[model samples]
Target: MSHKEALPKAAFQYGVKMADGRKTRRTGVGKRDDKAKLDRELQKINQIIARRKAEAADGGGVGTPDYKRPRY
Candidate 1:
Protein backbone atom coordinates (compact mmCIF):
# COMPACT_ATOMS: atom_id res chain seq x y z
CA MET A 1 0.00 0.00 0.00
CA SER A 2 1.09 3.57 -0.59
CA HIS A 3 2.34 5.68 2.34
CA LYS A 4 -0.54 8.12 2.05
CA GLU A 5 -3.01 5.28 2.04
CA ALA A 6 -1.34 3.67 5.08
CA LEU A 7 -1.40 6.87 7.13
CA PRO A 8 -4.18 7.37 9.59
CA LYS A 9 -6.92 9.61 8.29
CA ALA A 10 -8.26 10.91 11.60
CA ALA A 11 -6.93 10.96 15.12
CA PHE A 12 -9.94 11.28 17.37
CA GLN A 13 -13.15 9.59 18.34
CA TYR A 14 -16.06 11.07 20.27
CA GLY A 15 -17.25 9.04 23.23
CA VAL A 16 -18.01 9.11 26.92
CA LYS A 17 -15.41 8.26 29.53
CA MET A 18 -15.99 4.75 30.91
CA ALA A 19 -12.97 4.37 33.13
CA ASP A 20 -13.24 4.07 36.91
CA GLY A 21 -11.87 6.54 39.46
CA ARG A 22 -8.69 4.55 39.39
CA LYS A 23 -8.41 6.32 36.05
CA THR A 24 -8.06 3.07 34.17
CA ARG A 25 -10.27 2.16 31.25
CA ARG A 26 -12.92 -0.61 31.43
CA THR A 27 -12.26 -1.54 35.06
CA GLY A 28 -14.43 -1.50 38.16
CA VAL A 29 -14.42 -2.50 41.79
CA GLY A 30 -14.70 -6.19 42.57
CA LYS A 31 -17.09 -5.92 45.54
CA ARG A 32 -19.80 -3.31 45.84
CA ASP A 33 -20.49 -3.05 49.58
CA ASP A 34 -17.20 -2.79 51.45
CA LYS A 35 -15.24 0.28 50.40
CA ALA A 36 -15.60 3.99 50.95
CA LYS A 37 -13.18 4.84 48.20
CA LEU A 38 -15.20 2.77 45.75
CA ASP A 39 -18.34 4.67 46.69
CA ARG A 40 -16.61 8.00 46.17
CA GLU A 41 -15.20 6.90 42.88
CA LEU A 42 -18.57 5.70 41.68
CA GLN A 43 -20.03 9.07 42.56
CA LYS A 44 -17.29 10.76 40.59
CA ILE A 45 -18.02 8.53 37.61
CA ASN A 46 -21.67 9.49 37.78
CA GLN A 47 -20.68 13.14 37.67
CA ILE A 48 -18.66 12.50 34.53
CA ILE A 49 -21.62 10.77 32.88
CA ALA A 50 -23.85 13.73 33.67
CA ARG A 51 -21.34 16.16 32.22
CA ARG A 52 -20.99 14.17 29.02
CA LYS A 53 -24.77 14.07 28.64
CA ALA A 54 -24.88 17.82 28.98
CA GLU A 55 -22.18 18.27 26.37
CA ALA A 56 -24.01 16.02 23.92
CA ALA A 57 -27.26 17.88 24.45
CA ASP A 58 -25.58 21.22 23.78
CA GLY A 59 -23.75 19.95 20.65
CA GLY A 60 -20.46 20.60 22.43
CA GLY A 61 -18.92 17.39 21.11
CA VAL A 62 -15.30 17.13 20.14
CA GLY A 63 -12.75 14.46 19.33
CA THR A 64 -9.35 15.51 20.64
CA PRO A 65 -7.54 18.53 21.98
CA ASP A 66 -4.39 18.41 19.83
CA TYR A 67 -5.80 17.40 16.44
CA LYS A 68 -5.02 19.85 13.70
CA ARG A 69 -7.16 20.04 10.60
CA PRO A 70 -5.65 18.93 7.35
CA ARG A 71 -4.67 21.90 5.21
CA TYR A 72 -6.34 21.87 1.87
Candidate 2:
Protein backbone atom coordinates (compact mmCIF):
# COMPACT_ATOMS: atom_id res chain seq x y z
CA MET A 1 0.00 0.00 0.00
CA SER A 2 1.05 3.58 -0.62
CA HIS A 3 2.02 5.84 2.37
CA LYS A 4 -1.08 7.96 1.88
CA GLU A 5 -3.38 4.94 2.18
CA ALA A 6 -1.45 3.39 5.11
CA LEU A 7 -1.57 6.50 7.28
CA PRO A 8 -5.38 6.70 7.36
CA LYS A 9 -5.67 2.98 8.19
CA ALA A 10 -3.20 3.29 11.06
CA ALA A 11 -5.03 6.32 12.45
CA PHE A 12 -8.40 4.56 12.29
CA GLN A 13 -7.01 1.56 14.15
CA TYR A 14 -5.48 3.77 16.85
CA GLY A 15 -8.79 5.59 17.35
CA VAL A 16 -10.69 2.32 17.75
CA LYS A 17 -8.15 1.08 20.32
CA MET A 18 -8.45 4.27 22.37
CA ALA A 19 -12.27 4.13 22.28
CA ASP A 20 -12.25 0.61 23.68
CA GLY A 21 -9.76 1.55 26.39
CA ARG A 22 -12.01 4.42 27.55
CA LYS A 23 -15.08 2.16 27.77
CA THR A 24 -13.40 -0.22 30.23
CA ARG A 25 -11.64 2.40 32.33
CA ARG A 26 -14.51 3.43 34.59
CA THR A 27 -17.85 1.94 35.67
CA GLY A 28 -21.16 3.80 35.97
CA VAL A 29 -21.23 3.84 39.77
CA GLY A 30 -17.66 5.11 40.01
CA LYS A 31 -18.46 7.99 37.66
CA ARG A 32 -21.58 8.87 39.67
CA ASP A 33 -19.66 8.81 42.96
CA ASP A 34 -16.98 11.05 41.54
CA LYS A 35 -19.63 13.50 40.35
CA ALA A 36 -21.32 13.49 43.75
CA LYS A 37 -18.06 14.18 45.56
CA LEU A 38 -17.26 17.02 43.19
CA ASP A 39 -20.74 18.51 43.72
CA ARG A 40 -20.37 18.40 47.52
CA GLU A 41 -16.99 20.10 47.36
CA LEU A 42 -18.43 22.81 45.10
CA GLN A 43 -21.29 23.44 47.50
CA LYS A 44 -18.90 23.75 50.43
CA ILE A 45 -16.78 26.25 48.50
CA ASN A 46 -19.86 28.32 47.61
CA GLN A 47 -21.00 28.43 51.24
CA ILE A 48 -17.60 29.64 52.37
CA ILE A 49 -17.66 32.41 49.72
CA ALA A 50 -21.11 33.55 50.79
CA ARG A 51 -20.12 33.61 54.44
CA ARG A 52 -17.05 35.71 53.67
CA LYS A 53 -19.13 38.15 51.62
CA ALA A 54 -21.57 38.52 54.50
CA GLU A 55 -18.76 39.12 56.95
CA ALA A 56 -17.18 41.75 54.67
CA ALA A 57 -20.53 43.54 54.40
CA ASP A 58 -20.73 43.63 58.17
CA GLY A 59 -17.72 46.00 58.59
CA GLY A 60 -14.86 43.64 57.70
CA GLY A 61 -14.32 39.97 58.47
CA VAL A 62 -13.00 38.17 61.57
CA GLY A 63 -9.31 39.30 61.41
CA THR A 64 -9.73 43.09 61.17
CA PRO A 65 -7.17 44.95 63.31
CA ASP A 66 -8.23 47.85 65.56
CA TYR A 67 -6.18 50.89 64.51
CA LYS A 68 -7.06 52.92 67.66
CA ARG A 69 -5.41 50.39 70.00
CA PRO A 70 -1.59 50.47 70.52
CA ARG A 71 0.46 47.61 69.18
CA TYR A 72 2.14 45.20 71.68
Question: lDDT: which candidate is best?
Answer: 2
Task: Report per-prediction Cα RMSD to one decimal.
Answer: 25.8, 10.3
Per-candidate count of clashing residue pairs (backbone under 3 Å): 0, 0
Clashing pairs in 2: none
- C-alpha TM-score for every candidate: 0.37, 0.48
lDDT of 2 at 60: 59
| Residue lDDT tens for model 2, 1-72 | 556544587879878987877555445888899999999999999988887677668865346577742332
Find the candidate with the highest TM-score and give its number.
2
Q: Model 1, range 1-72, lDDT digits (tens) per residue?
A: 555545343421212232323345444554544587678989999988888677668765366343452211
Error of 2 at 53 (Å): 0.2
Among all windows of 10 consecutive residues in model 1, the one with the lowest summed lDDT is 11-20
Candidate 2, which segments miss by more than 4 Å at Cα? 1-27, 61-63, 66-72
Task: Tell me the lDDT of candidate 1.
Answer: 0.55
Model 1 residue 72 distance off true place after TM-score fit, in angstroms: 31
